[model samples]
Every structure is written in structure tokens, then in C-alpha cells.
Target: MKWRKEEQTPPPMEESAVPDTGWATTSMSTGAMANWTAVVRWSAWGLLLAGPLLGGWALASARTPVTVPTRAEAPRAQPASSDAVAPAGFAELYVAAYVKAGDSDADTEELSAYYPAARSMSWSGEGGAERAESASAVQVRQVSAGYWSVTVAARITSSSKNADSGRVRYFQVPVRAAGGRGASGWTAAALPAEVASPTSSKGVAPELSYGSAHAPLDSDPAVQTVRGFLAAYLTGGGELDRYLSPGTTLHAVRPAPYTAVSVTQIAEHGQGPAEGAEAQVPPDGVQRRLLVDVEGDGKHTGSRPMSYAIELRARDGRWEVAALEAAPALAAPGTKSNSEEGQGS
Candidate 1:
């Protein structure tokens, strides 16, 4: 296969009402009205003080409208756990693209501008000036209506800033898988606000190529088969593996060590990429997520590390990369804006 190589890289609320008493019933009258007067006077004071104070308290606790981000949220992608090795293909592609795009002098503002959800590429500086560092787990929390946990980590260096200023202020965020076993579908509600993009890319679909026979795995496959592929891709080396056919050895493993692949999410699945093609709908009426990851590696010997995807396809009873491309890695995730943005002692 022709490899396009490049290098470069809790809440609560309460309410109550005060009873009113007539002023006519006054205790000074030396009649039964005396107690009533006290009640009336006290009630008045209570109302006077309670109105604004109670109202303010209620307002404070009121639920505000969920402001949908002006720019869509970052697409949720689950970081494969250390033991959970993801399908090998796209990790390479994802990392490559991420780094190349991030490290270059190319106006990142444009990235923030062109795609609003892309604003996540900056680090506020809470990371502090690292005298030295290593790629540690960033954070994996729920962002949207999905079920997967996202992770943000970094492969740091011993310098003042990481990618910039040698402080190494960058985030490599990853989303966790949402769906349950025997169920290989997802929905918008299954994710956090961080990675879901409401907008769809128009015009051309990625002209991805699947190789021959054992190669170009058919996009049109049984749902069970697809699920198996995803499971394998996620686990790295496991049952029903993706990149492996028969006789494929573990040594074939290529570690994108410095590459930080964030949010490995599933895109979409259907009958199209294969012969008898059309949108492959889950009989149970579930949506299939398309998986993608972005990271970079400029150290690789090349002009610049170009990004490529290692997609999944089901062929001859197994899943494999349909197409192959080379790309750079992306900047790390959970990056802070300033020293105190998300800093913790």
C-alpha cells in the first residue's frame, strides 16, 4: 500500500407561607384581640423580610436553561484504557493529524474560528512550569449523553513548557464508550457535552479504500460482526481482533508512543461502503457511532507527519482497516487556559 508519510508534529429548595392576623385584635386592648395583634404585627414583619429574601433564594436555586454551546461541543471519543488497547489503525492516523495541526504556526484561531467546537486545543497554564514530565492520565469524566468515559492525558517532556513555552500546557482528552454489551449502537443522549457535534460535514465522504480480498473488509456485514470489530479495536489485542487475520503476530504491533490520540469515537455504520450498499440500520433501531482519533508525531523521519485513518471493515469473518494513511498527532487535552483555570493542588 502507498503510505502517505509526512512528519512535522447536588442542589436543594424550600418554601413556606406566613399566616395573616387582623390588626383589630390587639393585645393592648386587654381582650382576646391582644394575641391577634401580636400575630398580625409579626406576620407583617415576616412577609416584609421573607419576600425578597425568599425570592432571591429561589432565583439562586432555579435551574437555568442548558445553553447549547454556540459552537458544537467537541465530539466525544473514548480513550482506550491502558489495558483497553484500541484498534491499531486509526490511533496512528488520529495522533498524526492532531500534532501536525496543533504544533504548526498555522493560525489556531482559525481552527477555533472555522470550527467552534475546536476551541479545546488551548492550555490555560494550570499545568504549571513542569521542570520535567511524562504522559499521565489527564481526566476521564462524563461530558454528554453518551456512556463512554473520556480521558485527557499527555506524553510530556522535561522542559519548561510542553508544546509551547516549554510549560507543556496541553490536553489529550478521550471519551469512554457508552453502549452496553451485545448492543453496538449510540445516540446523542449517550454522551457528554464535550464531544458531540450537531453539524454534519457536507459534500464528499472520505474516499477511504479497503484492500483486496482479505483486505478491503466489507462495510456491509452483520451487526454482530461490527460490534466484534469495535470491541477488538477498543481492546487492542483481544478476541475477534480488527487488524489481525490469520498468522498476524503481536510483534506487528506499532506503538505510537509519543502520539496522543484523543476521543476515539465511532462515526457511523451502514451497507454503503460495500456492494449492496445503503445505510445499515440496526434492526432494533439504534444509531452506530463512527470512531475517530487525533494525535501527532513530528519526530518520525519525514517532511511532516501527515494524518490518515485506519478504518474498520468486516471481511472473511473479521474486521480490518479498510484504508491506510499517515498523519501527525494532536496537542494534548485537558489543557488549561491560565495557571488557575482548572488547577488543583
Candidate 2:
């Protein structure tokens, strides 16, 4: 066992051998990788160069403006005149134009401006006489959006071969807007008609009638109260306070200083509920309408009869005058005449 231990030895180490194709393979692989990298770089540079050029060409083409032909525009219409724009003002002007006084052809020509061709003959013979009409009150109501009904109370004066006279008259006229663009003027559809016939005689009584259900107005206590108030009002007495409702003024019934008025007869028109009746009462109160026939005597002229419509309302067991529409006097002087005051009831 001692001799065997002395003879043991390890094998000698050997170096690893390098292949002969190693350098060539390394060079080929490195060169191929370099070439691939160069091609990719060139491709990237080509894309970068082409992208901006394509985008610039597209943007330039898109931003280019195109020309187009256009037609000329038409002019806008001018607005209508101020006179034509206002309906009430036009109506007043129309009435004034037709009512002006003259005997010359110029007056007829002036009136013709307001009339249509068909109505031109209405004023044909108006040039031969001196006729004047003046409106003191004008009340207009619009019946529709395009039409209006006008009531004009006027004094008409004329000088003729027989006599020179003046009178009060009411006219009802219909007005409508003219058709067509930029034509805002309102035209009278036709000549006006008289609202009421003039009184024929002096101191003549009006025909009195009543509904079947209603009693005579003279017997009604409410009507008697009104009659007493009216008599006091016409006599220039200021004792109408008890007969009038609170805050009621009687400007329409003020007596003319130079004229004497006498109420001859009173007639009731419609039926009203009896006093203190609980059934079918109006909201304000029980209202009664009386048509009073009056005779007015001027200082120089004799007496003339006229009719008036008066509205009365019952309050606190008494009647008060609510409204009055009195006819004008027949002996009223012309507008040109030298008189202290015009005759109005």
C-alpha cells in the first residue's frame, strides 16, 4: 500500500483550439448588420424628406381659393310716409280734406286727391257752392285689424240762394287699409251717412212708447229723482249734489247762459229690475235709460225741440245721471259767425 501511493500522477491541461472560419464569419455578420442599419437610416431619411413635401403640397392645394360668379342684388323698398303710417291721423286728415270750404275748382281738385276714381264724381258739383264743415269730436273704433269705424260730430255751414244756415250733424264712416306693398294709407270705403235725422219742428213732442213689462217712466221714483236733478241743472242751480252719486260730475248737463232749456217729455226704453229685488241684478246697479225731449229758446231765436238720451243708475235708493247724449241745437250759428258760444246740449 505504501509503494502504490508513490506512483499516482495527474494528466496534463490542453488549450481549446480556435476555428479557422471564425474571423470570416464575424466579418460577414458585422458587415451585413452595418449594411442593414445603413439601409434603414437611408429609408428613414427618405421618408422624412418626402413627408414634409407631400404635406406642404396638400396644404397649399387645400388653401387655394376658388372664384365664383354672383348676380347683383335688388334694392330694398323705402318705408311708407308718416301720414300714411298712422290710421287715426290719416282718417282725420281725410275728413279735413273733404270738409274744407271753397267754391273754386281748386277745392274740388284738392278733395279729389283723397277719393278713388269711382268716387271722383261725388265732389263734381261741389265747386259751385260755398260749403264748410268742421268736426268738433271724432270717435274711432277699430272693428278689425284692417278696418275702422269712425263717428264724427260736426257743424255744417252753407250759404245758398234761399238762406244762409248752419246745423250740427253726425257722420258714420268706414275706413280700411289700402292694398299693395309700401301702401300703408287708409282709405274711406265710401261717403259717410247721417246718424240721426234732424228735428223738423219747434216744441214738438217725441212719440213715447214703453215695453210691455215696464211701467211709465214718469211714475218711477228713480226717474223722478233724475227729472228733478235735470230741472235744477238747467236752471243754473248747484243743488244736484243729493241726486248725483259720489264723485259724479255733470259737465255735459251744464246750462248755457244765453239759452233756456225745458224738458217736455221723458220716455223709458228698456226694462230694469225693481229696486231691492234680489233676482237678476247688474253688477254696478240697476240702470235705467230715458229719452228726454227738450225745447231750447235762444235770446233772439224762438224755441226749438230736440231729443236727448240720458242714462241713470240707482244707488242707495236714489237715481243719478250716469251719462248724457244730447242733440245739438237747430239754431246754432255758423263756425264763422261772431257768437259768444256755439250751441251744444
Candidate 3:
């Protein structure tokens, strides 16, 4: 009974501002195109500026010199000398010929081979005769590269009535050498000059490590071993290896030059085994150095005396000869054996 008419209003119409919308889209596109153009221009300029610099750097690297390291080479060896033996021998022979010539003009022809300009020589006496027994070149020294001075020792015996027996004299000769050792050439530079003998120190006594007070008794195993070894070595009585240590090499004298040998004295470097301890076994790896004086009864000749510096080592409680020492050890200056002083006191 109360239905009134309901009315609905129409929806609003869409706006038609097409040009404004198109203008807004076109403006955004233009701005984006300008940004891309600026970026491309910057990249092109950057590449153009760097191109010449990179090319110049590459050219400079190609033109520059390069050094590679290498290893150094070793020096070559020099050839052997030729002047050693020939000049020394020639000088010795010349000295012998000079002594025989002895102030005579007729005998000068012998000297002509050596001196070439010799007419005569000088002598102290008028009517004495001198002869050379033996001559040997003892020393040779280089004055320069190829020049040498050879000293010859000559034994001269005079036939004069009151003159003494044969005497030793030294003469020096100058020589020049050329060519190789196989094919040699030599010339005498000057005549011989009589010089003084080489210096001597025979009066002085050498101090050795072995002392007189350290003599070991004959019963000691080391002393017995040395005695037995010497007997075999000199007279060929037994096998030398029986007393020799391991790795030791020795040979007995061939043909048995002697009939018997006796050990005269033995001087040990340190304290020896206790008295009557010879029967007991010594410690293994023990070592002792000894100076042994020996006399050999020769088969045909008289008794000959000799000395040996020896080393002995112990293994399995037995002593064996080790080595023949090259030289006896020396004692320091102002050092005296304490055992000697103890015995004296």
C-alpha cells in the first residue's frame, strides 16, 4: 500500500583530455632520450682520450731492451811447465866440468860446451890438482818467468899433499829455458858462483810427546804385541796379520833381511796397564800410542838400530797394532813430564 517509486542517478562520464595525457607521456620520453644521449657522449669521449695513451705505452714496451740472466763460466787450467828438470841437470853437469878445468887454458874446451866464452879459470894454488867426486842439483828457484837459479852441491877431493880430505861445496848457476818438456832448449846465463851451505838446525833437539818415565813393562800386552810385530816385520818370523788390527795393511820385509830383532825400549803416551795385570783382559776399545826403539840382527851386516812411532787399539780385550804413525806427537814448549819429576822427588 506504500510502494513509492525508487530513482537511480546515471554514472559520471569519462573525461576526454587526450592531448594533455599525450603531452605528459612525450615529455617523459624526451627526458629519458636526453639522459641516454649524455651517457653515450661521455663514453665515446673517454675511449677517444685513452686510445693514444694505450698505443704509446704498447710501442714503448716493444722498443725497450730486455736482459736475460745467464750462468758464469769456469776458468781453464794452465799447461804444465817444462823448465823443472832440464835446467837443473844441465847446471849440475856444468859445475862438474868447471871444477875439472881449474885455471888451465888448454882444458877450457870442456867449459866451452857450457860457458862458450870461457878462456881460463881462477884457483888459489899454482900446482895443486882438484877432482870432483859427485855433484847434484839440490835447489832450483825461478828468478823471473823462464830464468832459473840452480844450486848444485859438489863433493871435491884435492890431490895436493897437505890439503884435507874430500869436502862438500855449493855452487849456483843461472839458466834460461825454452820449449816444452818433451823437446827442450836451455842456455847458461852466467858462470857458477860459490855460495854458503844451506842453514842447519841439527844442534837443536825436538821435544816429543813420549817421555822417558812412561816406559811400559815388557809384560804389558801392548809391549809384547809391538815386540812380536817387529820381529815378524824385520825377520819374517810369523804372520804380520796376527798382530795387526782390522782394516790395517802391512807386509813383512821380503827375503828376510834379518835373523832376529829385539825391542830395545818402549815409551807409551799415557799410563799403561797395572803391574801384573798383563794376564787379565784389558778393556775393549782401548787405545795407546808408543815409541818403540828396536835393533835387528842382520843376516850378513852388523846390528841395525831403528825406531817406530806406533798406534795400538784393543778389541775383544786383545791388543792389535793399528798404524805406523806418520810423525811422533810433539810436546809443547816449557812442558816437562810430570812422571819424571814425581820419580825424582
Judging by TM-score against the true structure, name the best candidate: 3
How many clashes does each candidate structure show, in the order listed? Answer: 97, 0, 0
Task: Write candidate 2's Cα lDDT for 115-234 as tens digits.
Answer: 453234534344425343666436777788777777766666655644434676666767777654434355677766658633344666432332222233554565566556655666
Q: Candidate 1: lDDT of 145? A: 37
Per-residue lDDT for 55 in model 3?
A: 81
- Name model 1 segments beyond 4 Å from true: 1-226, 236-243, 246-308, 312-314, 317-345
lDDT of each: 0.36, 0.58, 0.76
lDDT by residue for model 3 (1-345), tens = 999999988886555323554345543565687898899999999999999999878878886756565977686544335533558887888888877775555567667667766754454443227666899998988898778899999988877655454888889999776443323356677789999886473666676776564444766778788888988888988889999999999988888899998877777665555557766777877788888887889868888888889999988888899998988777767886534654588
What is candidate 3's TM-score against the reference?
0.57
Clashes, model 1: 97
Task: Encode model 1's per-residue lDDT on 143-234: one tens digit a residue.
Answer: 44343343323333433433443233333333334243212222112111223222343754332221111222335443334444333443
Worst 10 residues of 2 by lDDT: 336-345
* TM-score (all chains, Cα) for each model: 0.19, 0.36, 0.57
Candidate 2: where are CA atoms >4 Å away? 1-224, 252-259, 270-287, 313-317, 322-345
